[model samples]
Target: MEIKEYFHDSCVYFLNLEHRDDVLKKMSENVQEQSLVKASFGRAILDREKEFPTGLDTDHIGVALPHTDKEHVITPFIAVGVLEHPVSFQLMGGGNVEIEVDIVFMLGVTDPSAQVEVLQQLMEMIQNEELSNKLESAQTKGEVISSLQHFTSLMS
Candidate 1:
């Protein structure tokens, strides 16, 4: 299963939101409305994120990987959101620690096993400060996808 198959130029977006819920809502709506996920997708993601945050804080960037069950997904895809201002999110596995997130990688994985591999790729991405910095600074959707091309194929 190629991970790049899950991304589309239409899935990339730039958002300006104040709260964590807004960020999740924006991305969830995009993925759902794009016909990638089911109608229940947004609600599932929001509920899941509240219980188990997927926030990650790296050296050059902070990101959240919010997702829910496979049942809520129709076609597996990813929605990229670059926030205008950093939004607060509870760090993944870091109790009581919050990070100001600049990006959000809203994952829509329909296959249960594929979830691990996707998250692995994302975790590997955060380690590369250069790549994350480029993505964070990217002004357009194409630029963001270009920055991620090293680790992900734009054409699947």
Candidate 2:
């Protein structure tokens, strides 16, 4: 149930790289913050986002979950990138209108069934204001990972 179980430490980052393509750029930034296995990861999520759109507009805030094929992932991971600036993404729940996404949870799931579980866990985390606040304010990789671990553990 823990993100680390699926997402390795190498795959977790703060997203500090640059690129011409926004999606690739973001993923590169996240790679800089999180992993070396990022170019493919970013490309995958960008492609998926273009097709399926992972942006979600909840009662509390708007967020995006960009992910790609499991094969690109060395281990299952949910790389979280907190953008210093929000980006526009289409919402999954309603209209075509976009939302400013401050939090990006990139999921790397090999088993399709695990996708739902990850989504559910992410949804629960987003619903709690305290948890969301913690994630938004997390200044370090350890802080982000620990917070996610604490919440997921308690939920299970």
Candidate 3:
């Protein structure tokens, strides 16, 4: 309700992609067009995700947080992608755990210090199954935006 910081309307989308690369590419393109991130964002994310995964499998929903270093970002923006179907992504943990993630939160966090804060806030949302339910049930882009806005507000 408080002006919804970090949640940009242009950055939110409901995507239909069979491959994980497509999802990353879409977010990467949007970020570059919107001046949120540099052109290398897509490649960097793809490479980094291979080395250090970012998938989390919650009981309610599976999500992936794909991101790169702050140097590639021009401003802090949280891009939300609601995939039509699940796409495979490896876990950030050392083990070779693979998760089918339906939601992808591609973070273009310019500030170094805020990365942890943003992830912590997002982690809190991930910890709550109800939020995942809301996201899963959302029918429109507006509904997803509202869900994210509500989620961010509750963190304060």
> Candidate 3 lDDT, tens digit per residue, 97-148?
8889988888888777778888887878877898888887777878888888
Error of 2 at 88 (Å): 1.0
| Clash tally, candidates in order | 0, 11, 0
TM value for model 1: 0.93
- Per-residue lDDT of 1-156 in model 2, one digit per residue for the tens? 454376444545554423214744565455535544445666666666767777887776667877667666654667677666667787775457677776777776767788888888888888887777887777877777778777877887
Off by over 4 Å in 1: 153-156
Q: For candidate 3, what is the TM-score?
A: 0.93
Model 3: how far residue 10 lies from native, Å: 0.7
Give one digit per residue, the lDDT tens place, for model 1 in 16-113. Answer: 89999998988888877778888898899989988998899887788999989999998888788988899999999998899999989998898999
Q: Best-fitting candidate, measured by TM-score? A: 1
- On the 0 to 100 scale, the lDDT of residue 124 in model 3 is 80
